[model samples]
Target: MLFRFLVFLYPVIRTLGPATAALLLIAGISLIGYAVLRQPGLWSWLAAGACLLSAGLLALLCHSYHWWLFKLRPHGSLFIPIK
Candidate 1:
């Protein structure tokens, strides 16, 4: 169930850019680690792990589409050329 949700998030994250994806991945891992050490319930652990996995997949997706993600935007023109 969680895996399916993460799969769906891949394309959304890919459009967000590598830096954002990487930051999210790092934050997710940190949260999972913190939960493992402080949380007592199995559900909490599973939830944290799912978040971490999702972030990791997002990062990978972003990296795979890096070039497309950072494509140059069209520049604005000062004035329209006379036809």
Candidate 2:
């Protein structure tokens, strides 16, 4: 459950930087591999797949929305309003 949540937030965290994102992604993959090896089951695989799919979809949606916003407003401002 927590792992899925982390996967879902993967893209968001990726905005930090490529190196950081790559490291985190590798860690996540390792964790996933460990889970699969520890408990090899059909349901576990299905759940992992589903989590990955949803996370990818979410990342796509976020990227598209960010692109749209950038297109709509070309000002040099970030999508996240930092104070």
lDDT of each: 0.58, 0.53
Lowest lDDT sum, 10 consecutive residues, model 2, at: 74-83
TM-score (C-alpha) between model 1 and the true structure: 0.46
lDDT of 1 by residue, 4-73 (tens): 4434565665466566766766776777777778876787677767777777776665665433323322
TM-score of each: 0.46, 0.41
Clashes per model (N, Cα, C within 3 A) = 0, 0
8: Cα error in model 1, Å? 15
- For residue 58, give model 1's deviation from the true position in Å: 1.2
